[model samples]
Target: MTDLQQNYAHVYNNSVGFGRYPCLILIDFAQAYFDPDCPLYAEVDSALASALRLRKTAQTANIPIVLTKMTYDVAGVTGGRFFEKAKPLEAFLPGRATGEFAKGLVPQPTEIVVEKQYPSAFFGTSLASTLICLGCDSVLLTGLTTSGCVRASCVDAMSHGFRTIVVADACGDRHDAPHQANLFDMKAKYADVVSEAAALEHLATLVTRG
Candidate 1:
């Protein structure tokens, strides 16, 4: 292992187990992040495919699913400082097609859809309370741009007292460097990083227990 990896291995690296009840959080799987023609596109087909598989499993297991989309007012008023810093967020301006959820991955009618103008879904939304109401003790996260929205959501999920699990293969970023680095950092600190297959297996166990 590299020196930095070894350092983290000796101290910060430790796994967090799933809690009794878990909810799935799909963060920002919007068209802007998936459309090749869009500047925000991240080439996340593998992650998207894994997330689809995880979504199917979650649905079958009756897990609570929360889908988050980033949206801003027509005037970009709600995004605040973040909007000013990242003008590219304008892609999600009200009524913009880029703000819509990707086709085939849209939330089901039964799923909860939380719209926010920030990176963390819980920042200005009802996500935490909703998860509590659903009796979710843990969050299984699958989403786009691991270095940004996914990382932000994972940290906030943990801060909200939920066991946070970042489905590694189901989370993507525009580049591998940030993706891998943030995954490592999150695994070492904020959340547990697991694969889509592992998440599915855990969901199966939950079903068997019930």
Candidate 2:
């Protein structure tokens, strides 16, 4: 197998096991979608700022950064079912600015942007393969709708054998209760949930030795 294929296999086989490498995964931070007025909006203003800082820190550390956005066809071909069910107050029509990543948290040219149609970033997506290609064994997750997209991504990351860490304060939900609930469950079962401060402190340790 090619080295890339081997890495992919390793990730699949060891799902949840830590690898020597690490990457950062930022879930759905699109401007229109993340609005406070949206149905899924979570008042995570503090978290958003923290996420931006983390993105910068990761960039400085030369870590691979991957960002995701929920995009639909201009005619809403995809996620139409979603629109009917959830009726997102804000939807990501294709080729629109609303679906774009938040300007404040824009991805650098070197960063990867993965457009997804579902909750889990890995679902029908190449996120796993991309992580493997980047030699990423662990994923530091930050993003919006803590109880939804952020939580889903974390779970899948863990299941894919990646050491998943969710920056608690770097993720937001529309309300306090659901956010707290998801975080608690994630910590107990799926992933390690830590505050943004804590994640940054831990990352500092990694950087100091390098």
Candidate 3:
């Protein structure tokens, strides 16, 4: 009930709610965010753990999971202004160790891996079409840097006409201010911001495909 929360209370309170067919999207949980040597490190291990647990749940439920990572060509021209502004993106250069998925999280051959040079996975990528093909009416989003990639994907998921839910526990940022701020904004506008427990409950109610 802070003044800020009160100001936007009733107007922004509608919930998109979890949809019948959902897809889990793990955004940019790469080595760059986990490595101490990398400037992009966010010290968000708990978020990763939560996401892994959610991933396990999704696996058991036979839910489709999609992972996205940053990838750029040799010249790094693909990333354009974003690459120029955030030099840390160089860590994602081809063949770099930082470009790989973080330890303990590996994509199975059956899973889809979308590589991109931008914050929103749907931008310049096939993610939206893929989700449509899968008949995904909703998206379960989890990833590092709540203020960055997670926020971007959440917005895009909504714009793509999918009911989006951002798992709060499974998402984090380098600082709590931006993390909490963006969560508040996203909840009020673009997506459903939910806890890990609530997300799990939603998953349990889903009917898995054969």
Top lDDT hit: 3
Decide which is better by lDDT, 1 or 2: 1
- Candidate 3, 109-141: lDDT as tens digits: 878999989999899999999989998899999
lDDT of 1 by residue, 1-210 (tens): 788987877699778898888998888888898778788988888888888888888888888988898988888989999999998898899888988988788678999999998999899899999989888999999898899999999999999999999999999999999999999999999999998889999999877877
Worst 10 residues of 2 by lDDT: 10-19
Task: Give residue 71's error in model 1 in angstroms.
Answer: 1.3
* TM-score, ranked from best to worst: 1, 3, 2
Give the clashing residue pairs of candidate 1, or none: none
Q: What are the per-residue Cα lDDT tens digits for candidate 2 across 1-210?
A: 777446546343322433356787888887764565545444566777888888877767778888998977666657656556665624577665667777687678999989888788887699999898878889988887888888888889888988888888888877788888888677767777778777777666567755
Clash count per candidate: 0, 7, 0
TM-score of 1: 0.97
Error of 1 at 161 (Å): 0.7
* Error at 8, model 1, angstroms: 1.0
lDDT for each of the candidates? Answer: 0.89, 0.76, 0.90
Instruction: Please identify model 2 stretches exceeding 4 Å from their true place.
Output: 1-19, 33-41
